[model samples]
Every structure is written in structure tokens, then in C-alpha cells.
Target: MMDVGRHPNIKLLAYSEIESISGYIGNFHVRVRKKARYVDETQCTACGECAKVCPVAVPDEYQLGLSLRKAIYIPFAQAVPSAYLIDMKACLGTNPIACGKCAEKCDKKCINYDMQDEIIEFDAGVVIVATGMDVYDPTELEEYGYTRYENVITSMEFERLISAGGPSDGHFIRPSDKRRPKTVGFIQCVGSRSERRGKPYCSNICCMNTVKDTLLLKDHYPDVEAKVFYIDIRAFGKGFEDLFKRSKEAGVQYIRGIPGEIIEDPVTKNLKVMVEDTTTNRISEHELDMIVLSVGVTPRADMPEVQQLLTLSKTPDGFFMEAHPKLKPVDAPTSGVFFAGCAEAPKDVKDSVTQASAAASRAMTVLSAGKIKLEAITSVINPEICRFCTICAQACPYKAIKVEPKKKSIELIEAMCKGCGTCGAECRFGAIKMRHFTDEQTYAQIDAYLEEDPYNKIIVFACNWCSYAGADTCGGARLQYPPSARLIRTMCSGRVDEDWVLYAFRKGAPIVVVSGCHFVDCHYIDANRWTQKRVEKLWDKLEKLGIRPDRLFLEWISAAEGQRFAKTMIDIERHRQRVTKEEIEYTMKVLSEQK
Candidate 1:
């Protein structure tokens, strides 16, 4: 990152937060709040003379609060800019007027207490999000005894203890008495792969990290006993399995079970871990001087803030969602914004670096072109037909519809619009229209299906990726279903708006079924969840309007579930037969008049 920061083409802007983002992909106007660093980067030489004279000391976050740092100090040894930054929160001038010795001792006089935050605006052709991840806190799992026992420490704290510049100067010692330990226990998956406390996804680095830490211990202390408790050793990467094997060959004991509890010894301040070996079917207890909890990685705490800022969608696990996991892994649903590293999902260091490189290449592909070609399926607003009600603006999920209050007109940004037709469906005045799937195209399909045998037909709106594919799978498998069904495919279930559902009823269709991917496994991230919510609202409205809610159904059918899809359609057809022609006619008349 420091090397990239030194690139002449890339003007590095540090200590900045994005305040606002406007416009669309190719010509985005971004406003950034450049926070004050209070030191001149160009003038200061990163010498340690100023830091030595500073009296104010605070816990160093880079060392995981295991060490102290001067008020005016560098973040770390390899920190970019290689310059001192004043800790305004800890500095005497900002907190209180107790001391100003650091400012007085600086030879270059770079310290400035009066600097204020400045806002700057810039045009970006592309944006890459690589905010990375945070370690899960094990304090909530009280059974681990993390907060109570000084011998129990997280993997991050252990990393610092093994580093040369760490608090104890790379000496592995017990936190209670600073004595060398003969036995250490590594507990794997402390907050991973468990639905009870933390996330369910496998944190990709924990297994390898434990292996690396065990190797580090063996290098420093040859006779020290190291044991690792894991459900299964996941060493899938290149040379990773070799490292795992090497650790075992070097006499590190591998246990096949996570410890249930860690009890502290009263006399020696050691830890006694209780575990049941699944292979041997035996419960065992081990005494260890130090216990390192191999914590899992989770999405950043401010992920929701970033999601709103970029208008990006998130998966059920709260990590940023990719446009397509296999096809467009780095790209976000919003075209220009891309994801890298653990921000997308849990990944190892090698995967992170690979993804970072891929993200850089993807961003360069957009910026190097100097212009972007938008998809043909974007939304369009007709100025002459627009009523200027601003309903489209309110309904658009991507904020693609822009209304000019001064002109009293609405404009659709082609780059930002996803062609979901949600705005067109919500617009009461029929002002907005999607390009490929326009109102006329949709109505034509409905007219074709319902023009003949309208009262007996069952209308099904299936999403392209999942439900539609499921229908194909049913046909390929020769699954038996009713022939009275008519299908219309959309890009996603979210595209099946409320007006469309009501419109099907108005066309004399006895039953209307909206189907898509299952929740959390949506092709468009959480789009299916929105579809679920809309269907529920429609059911409520039907019940309130004295219409039978059973006439409408919402089902989640994955592409692999051919038998289930065939059974669902057959079952719905059986129910549709219960509605007589007179009841269908009466319902259609009432719905049409109401619309």
C-alpha cells in the first residue's frame, strides 16, 4: 500500500472520510472530509527525537494495547508518509493544558494545534472498497474465561507477543507473572463456524494462523509443548497442508475437538481446558500456562454506513455482496464500485492479496478507458408524461431517478438505473418506463396469456436466475405439472412489482404465483427478501380489500429443485380449480375498477 501511495499517478489522500456521493458511474462527484493530521507530511523526516522528548504516553493500538506510544508518534514502523501524527484525543493542548513538551522539542516545528478539518470534492471514474475486516471479540463467550483469566488471550494479542517490536520484546511469557511457559494451548474457531455466538462461515485464516503461531513457538522454545484443538484442520491452499504437516511433525499435538471450557488454576494462574475428543470418544483435560483463542474475522463494524454511502447491497452475513459470485466477484451491484479482500467474505492473506490485485485491475479497466458504456436495460423517464410527483424518486432502490425541483422534471441516470422497473410500477402517473421490459412489453405478455381461457389460466411470474431455471429443470426432468400455467420471466423477483400482481388479477387470472430464489441466497443479494416483503404486503392488502389472499402465492424455488417446482405448480393448479368462473369475473371486475 505504501508503494502504491508513492505512485505519481495516484495522488494519495489520507485521513479522509467520504461525506457525500452524487452523480453516476462515469462522472461521480464525491465529497470527502479530510480530517486534520496536525503535522506537515512533506516537511517532517520521521526522526525519533520529537517522540523521545514527548511526555504524554498512551496505549498503542498497533500493539493491541499491550504497549505504550508517545502522543506524537508514527502509527507503525512501515506506516505510509513515515511521519508523526499528534494524538489529539490524548494530547494535553486538546484534552487539557497540562503539557506541551512535544511541540516545544520538535526540531522542524511541524506540530499545529489550530488545524481544522477540510472538505474536498473530486471526480472519480471508479471506486474500490477494500476496507478489510475486524477480529471477533471473544469477551461475549464467557465460557472461554477471556476477560477473567490473564493466561487467556486472543490470537491478535498473541501475534504482538511473538513480534520483535511487541510489548514483551518477542518474549513468550505468562501475562500474570511474566514467566516463560512450557505448555501453550491453541483453541481454534473461537467465534467461527458456530451459529450460537458468532458467524457460520469458515474464517479462512484461523487454521493457517494457528499453524504459523505453533511454528513460531517451536522456533523460540524447542521443548515447549503446543497443542491445537480444532474440529477439522483446513489447510487447502498451496503449501498450507505442508505447513500443517510440518507443525505436527515438529511435535505439536493436534486435537480434534474445540474446548468446552477453560478453568483457571488458583495457585499457578494457569488454564485447564476441558474437551471431548470425537475420534477417541473420551473427555480429557489439559493444563496450559497460556491459552490463545484463534478468533474469527468478521465484516467491519461500519459496514452498514459504507453500504448506504455506496448504495451497495449486503449478504445475510452482512458482508458486501458481489454482483455475481463466480462471474463478477469483484464488482458490486452498483457498477463502478468494486469489493476486495475480507470485505466480500472471510479470506486468507494470500486470497486477500490476490483479490486486491484483481480489484486494482478492475478499477484501472474503467479509469483507463476515460468513458463508460452503459447497459441497454436502464430506466428512462419521459418528461412530457411525467407528473413531477417524485414518486419514482421515492420508489427507486438505487436512487437512480433524479427530480429537478427547479425544472419540475425527472431525469433518470442511465448508469445508476438497474432497470428493475420498481419506479415504473410505483409511478401512479405512468411517467417512468424501463428500456427493454417496458409497460407495453409486459402488458403484451399478459394479454397473450389471458386473451384466451383467461378465467382458467394460472399466471406465474418467475425470476430469471432461479425460478425460471427451476421451471426448465422440471421440464428437463420430465416432472408432471398442470398445463394451465402461463409463465413470464423477469431479471429478479424484486422486478415483480405490486402493480404487476394486481394487473394479473385484473386480467381474469384466477391464481397468480410469484416465485424466486430462497432468502439470503438471492442472485442479486437481498433482492429476494424485498420480494418476500412486497408479497406479504400484497397479501395484507388483499385481506383488507375483502379479496381472498389464497388467490396469490409466493414461493422460493431454487434452480436445483425441479421436483419441488413441479409439485408446487401442480398444487397451486388444484387450488385454482376451486374458483368458479362467476367468482373469477367478480374478482377481476372489482380489481380493475379499484386500480
Candidate 2:
């Protein structure tokens, strides 16, 4: 942190928050709110004079509310800029009559309660999201007795208790009695891997953290007894198993079960832990001087706001979703943004460092290039034919389109567009045109595919990223399917215009199968959603036209689903075989008669 503060190229805006984010990938504009510290950072020498005179005291959040701090004090000992900041909320008031003891004591006279927050704006080429995670609160897990019993504390509190600069000054003591604990019990998964009250996903750091804590406790006081209650000791990291073995060698007891309940002895402030010993298949009760609930980590509370500002997407677990989990692990779906640390997932120190470095490299690559290379397959609009309806703008997932109602113009930002053809498909006035995939080209492919054996043929509309790749995977695996199916590839299932399906059916094709990436896993960030809706409309149109809606199949295929793709093709062939020649003729006649 000190290095970052001192770096000439780095401009660290400490105690500031992002207000809004705007513009494209290489040209991002940012607005920030620099909250008032009520102290001149350049003048304050971080001396103890002002803090000593301050009358107001509040629970120190840095110490997890285990200690008290004055209103005018540094956040921590090693804080950057080496300055004091007043907590306006904790201070008596900004008015002159309330309190001014700290200001009077300051030799540099940096304290100023009249100071106000400042807003700053800047521009950047790229951005990286490294908003770290917060630990889960154990208060909601009432069974753990976190708040009920003073002897029962969280692992974070335990950390502060053992730290050299902590309130207890490295003395590992129970909160109730302030005495060094002889028998300490650690409970694992307090707010992790439980569908009942906590997160269902595994909180990656809890197990190894407990292992290190046990070693620390046993090392500090050799005679002290440390017991760990857990579902499993996840010693999967490099040298982790060896460290786990060393902890056991140091006389740390490992119990394979989480305690069901904790009962506190009112007189002695000791805790009685009730748990079924899974290894022995018997219930047991253990008495402990102190209990530490190893809590899990969760996404920060402001994740949704961050997503809205950057136009980013998130996984179901609330972590930022990468563009592609395998190919672009650190890259955000937003063009110039990337992710690092626990903001992406619950990762350990080693993985977080690795991802942070990767994100830095990605940002550097774009910065060095000085220019963004847009793909050739981007969407364009014909201003003459456009209705300025803004449907294309509203339907765009990337927010790449701009609308000017007064000017009667719709502008497409080619650099921002991913060319999913969703806007083109949604444009009823035939104004939008995709670069590579156009209406004329798509019609040509359909006519060519159904030229021979039109009745016996199965016309399949496959997406370029997933379903087409799925077909290739099926063929690569040598999966046996009927040869009568002819596939027409589009950038996305959204690119498959409703007219294309009708045209294929009008050409006497027996069946049409439209497939794309799964809805949640769309390559173009939910472009396949429009595909699903368009298919539903086609189903209705077919039904109303005296045609079997079953003749049109909608399947969600992924790049990895080779077997499933093969099965879909085989099913479509079966349906094609069942379609009579008379039925095909009638369908062609009906489609041809429509407009």
C-alpha cells in the first residue's frame, strides 16, 4: 500500500467511491465522490496528540468491534497517506458549539469539521474490478451462539485477539473473562455449505484458515488444547496436506462433525459443545474455554450497484461472471473491464494473486495497443428505411445502440456491438443489416439446402458459437445420426429470422430445428433469449396456419453437448420420416399463400 501511495505513475484516490461509469471500451469516463476526512491529508502528521484529546469514542470496525477508537484517528496503523480522518457520524457535530477538542490540540491544525465531500472525474482506457469479499456474519446462525454467549466468538475476532497490535495485545483470551483459554474449540462451516440458513456453495478459505489457526494456538501456548469440528479437512492446496499433518502432530484434535448446539456455563463463561462424532457413530459433549466460529466469505453488499454501473453480468452465486469461464476467465462481459480476487469467486490467496496478475496483463495489452480492433461482423443500419422506433436500441443486450428521436436517427456503435443480429431480427422496418449474415445471404443458404429431396430433408438452424460447434463435436466423436439433416449456421439463434424458418417450410422442408447456446450460458449475453421468443412466435404462427407446431423444434444446445446434439438430430430425422408427402405439400401451399 505504501508503494502504491509513493508510485509516481499511480494516482491513488483514497477514501473515494465511483459514482458512475460511462463511454466505450477504450474511452471510459468515471465520476468519483471523495468523502471528506475533515483533516488536511498533506498537513496531518498522524501524531497521537489529536486522538488523545478527542472525547467521542466508537467501536473500531477494523478490529471487528472488539476495540474502541476515537472520532479523530487513522483507520489502522499502516494506513496510506499516514493521516487522520474524522468519523463525522461518530463526532459530536460539525457545528462549532458541539466539540472542537481535537482541532485545538493539532499542531499542524489539519482538523476542519467544515470540510465537505469533493467530486472528481477522470477518463481511463481500461478498468479492472478487484472489489474484495467480506466475511459472512455468524449472528444469523443462532444455533452457534455467536452473540448470545461472550465466550463464543468468530474466527475474525480470534485473529484480532491473537494479533500483536490487537486490543488484547497478542493475548489469546476469551471475551467473557479476558483470560488465556486452555481449551479452544473451532467450528467449521458456520455460514457455508448449508442450504438451511447460509450459502450453499463452499466458502473456499474456511478449512485451511482453521488449520493455520490451530497451529498458531498450539504454537503460542504449548499446553493449550485445540479441537477442530468440521465436515471435512480440505487440505487440497500445495503443501497443505503436509501442514495439516504437522498440526495433528502438534496435538491438535480433529473431529469429523459440526457441533449441533453450544451451551454456555453462566458462572465460568465456558462453552459446552454438543456434536455427534461421525467417525465413531456416537454423540459426545465437550467443554471449551472459548469457541471460534470459522465463518465463510461472501460477495460485497454493493455488487449489484457495481454491475449496473459497468453493465456487467453476475453468476447465480452473486460473483461477477467472466465472459467465458474457460477462454476468458478474468475478462468481464463489459468490453474494457476485467475481474480479479474474490469479486469473481471465493478464491484463496494463491488463486486471487494469479487472477489479479492475469487481469493486469489483460489491461496492459489493451493499453499498449492504443487502438481496439473491432470484428468485421458488426451490425449496420439503413437510415432511409429506419423508423427510429428504438426497438433495436431497447433489444440490444450490450447497450451498443444510440437513439436520437429529434434527429430521426438511430446510431450503431460498431465497436460496442457483438453482432448477435438480435437488433436486425427485431427491426420490423428492415432497417438493420448484419455485416456477414444478411437476409439475402440467409435466404440463399435456405434455398440451396432444401433444393434436393425437400420433403425428406430436416432443416436445422444452428448457432455459430454453440450449436454449430456442437454439430462439429458430434461429427468429431463419430456419433451415428441420420444423414438427411442439413444445417444452416448463423452467428446466433437470434440471427435466424422468422422469415427464414417460413421460407424453409415454404420450400416443402419436412422439419426445422432451431438451436443455440443455453439461455443462461449465451455467448452474446442472452441473445438466445430473443431466439426463444421468436421460436414461440413461429410455433403460434404454424399452429394458426393449420400446420403442426410439433414440426418446429426448439432445443438449447451447448458447445460441450455432442451426445445431446446427436440425439436432437436423430429425433428430428424421426419426425421428418413421420411427416407425409401430402402434409409437406400442404405446408408449402399454406406458407406460399401467406402475403
Best by lDDT: 2
Total clashes in model 2, counting residue pairs 3 or more apart in sequence or in different chains? 0
Model 2 lDDT on a 0 to 1 scale: 0.90
Q: What TM-score quantifies how close candidate 1 is to the native fold? A: 0.95
Model 2, residue 204: C-alpha shift (Å): 1.8
lDDT of 1 by residue, 1-595 (tens): 6887789887777778888887777777899998887887777899878789887899999998888998888998888778888888877764456566767777898878888899999998888898889999999999998979998999999999988888899988878999989999999998999999988988989999999999999988999999999999999989999999999999999999988889998889989988999999898999999999999999999988888888888887878989878888999988788888999999987898898899889988998888887777767788888888887777676788889767887778877877666677666677777777776787889989999988789999998888999999999999988998899988778778788888888889899999998875576545566677789999999887777999999999988888999999999998899988887888788887797
lDDT, candidate 2, residue 51?
Answer: 89
What tens-digit string does per-residue lDDT give for candidate 2 at 1-595? 9998999999999999999988878988999999999999999888889989899999998898999999888998899989999999888754755678898889888988889999999999899999998889988878777889998988889899999989888888888878888999999988899888878889899889999999998889989999999999888989999999999999999999898889888899899988888999988899999999999989999998998888787777778889999999999877889999999999999999999999999999999999989978989999999988898888787889999978997788887898899999999989999998999998888889888888878889899989999999999999987898888889989888888889999998899999998876787777888889999998999999999999999999998899999998887888888999999999999988994
lDDT for 248 (candidate 1): 96
Root-mean-square deviation per candidate = 2.1, 2.2
**lDDT at residue 160 of model 1 (Cα atoms):** 94
TM-score of each predicted structure versus truth = 0.95, 0.94
